[model samples]
Target: MDQVKTYRTNVRIGNWNEDLRLEEDAKNEYLEKKQRGELAAQKVEVLKQNMLRPVDLTASSDGRLHFGDVVMLVNMGGENRARSTVSINADINSLNKTPSPAIQAPCGISAGQCVDACTRTAFIITSIDGSPEGSTLHFEQSFALRTTSGFAMGLYLSSDLQSFQKCSKKSRLQEVNLDDKCSFLTWWKILHFDPQERLEYEGQPVPANEDVVIIHCKTNHALAALGDQVLWTTYGKEYEVTAHTFLDSHKAEKDTNHWMLCTAENRLELLNQSQSTADNQEPTEANPGI
Candidate 1:
């Protein structure tokens, strides 16, 4: 039996008026050349949905998973144009299941061109001691950040998976309301959003705590945070964070845990953080420290 196969590609046709604004004969020649390219491209299928452009992927506490972004093309110097999170069933092979749209943030640009183009760089799940339902999945959009921009923007998928809300109250696409001193990446690290380990809170295996992200940006500054609270910020021109790893030091030590960060210069810097939640010295009726 002879088999029929289809090949696919993605391309942007050049603007006729702009590219052919020369003499009539030159314009005609240019169009003829472009037409040949277009005809050749039609021989193969042009994949329209960018399912491989996701910057991050994470599973929920219940084992349901989601991935970020569906771009048309990720070109050079392109910013994140991802806009939604497509939720997947726990059993990936389940038949006839459609991707449920859970998180959506319209960029408010050209309609239908890129309806959901907000780029998401990272995703993390956090269950603070006092948060609603004890946990929520966070999606980060870092493409909108600048060197000195205020606020990293993101969307929050509620624990129940029923709604999506903006993490920043001033939820504009171009600029979100985040801390002035932090970019989206720094805050992402500060939140300890990745390399999640299975943890036991009240005697069950769940994703919890580990909310300390150390961000070493291009500015040669290292910043650490414990769930949004800045622990320390230090500057060293020679230090540019290249990677982070968990060092299992002080296995018997409960108060402080150690982590290692690799720098551009190939030096490892160890960071220690206290996990103890008790403070007896500054006990007050209305305020308790953790």
Candidate 2:
């Protein structure tokens, strides 16, 4: 009988399997955190059942009022006597120095209800350190009657009130057109023509107009137009005819004096007009016939 040979192989775990295990652990941890957050929010809602009330007693150590002492109150704004008794609670301690109170109570208190028969409003002591003064007392008064205008509290009465003003309507701004013209030509330098019922050159004879043809040096690409036209070549060159329109010869004369020519290519060259004499110059109203 022939002897049988058997081989045992050890298999190694791949990185893909390890990555999948890590992703699963991360997803489980995220879910656990979400559940915990929801539970904490529910606990906060349950705690809101208890409301705060002020005390009228003064602090024994400092003259400051304690959390539950009751006292008389008065409104200096209007000599209004309050009908209801005031109580000191935690709500009174939170008030700032400003007489105007921004805190909204579950039951609203009125200015008339803030004072007593002797013009003294009775308030309970709720907070020992009610204010920075330490001696300040916070009080609340309640009554069955409700005022049409809500009660004003704290410094809100003494301070200046702000009024709203209507805003003015916005005016539209005029748009300026820097590149608007009729006809033009580029022969190393650009020359422009005027716009009329029919297309014509500004200086050169109409028969020689040649339809303002533009020819690219390398590609020999050609573009032609009868009047004011703009052309874009494949080589990224743009040619515009009469890029600027002038009202009269006087305006055109001023532009020519300050005219600057620039190439669309990397290099910019200035066209030389010094060689042209007065006899060869074109005629214009300002130049009296060039």
Candidate whose TM-score is highest:
1
lDDT of 1 by residue, 1-290 (tens): 88766543544356856664667778788688567533323312111111112332222344321122111111111122211111111111111112331222221111011112223222232222233432333322112121110111243211111113532112211112122232333332222323242131222222222222322232212221112111111110111111222233432211111121111111101111111222224767777544
lDDT of 2: 0.24
Error of 2 at 257 (Å): 80
Task: List the global CA lDDT of all models.
Answer: 0.23, 0.24
lDDT of 2 by residue, 1-290 (tens): 98776643554456978998899998988778566533444323322212222222222343222333222322112112111221112132222223432222222122222221111123222221223332322211111111112121211100011113311111111111111111111111123322241223333321211122212222222211111222222112222211122234433222211111111110111012223444577878888862
Superposition error at 100 for model 2 (Å): 24
Query: What TM-score against the true fold does each predicted structure earn?
Result: 0.19, 0.15
Model 1 residue runs over 4 Å out of place are 1-24, 36-57, 61-214, 217-290
Give candidate 2 regions above 4 Å deviation. 1-54, 59-72, 75-109, 112-158, 162-290
Instruction: Give residue 129's lDDT in candidate 1 (0 to 100).
Output: 27
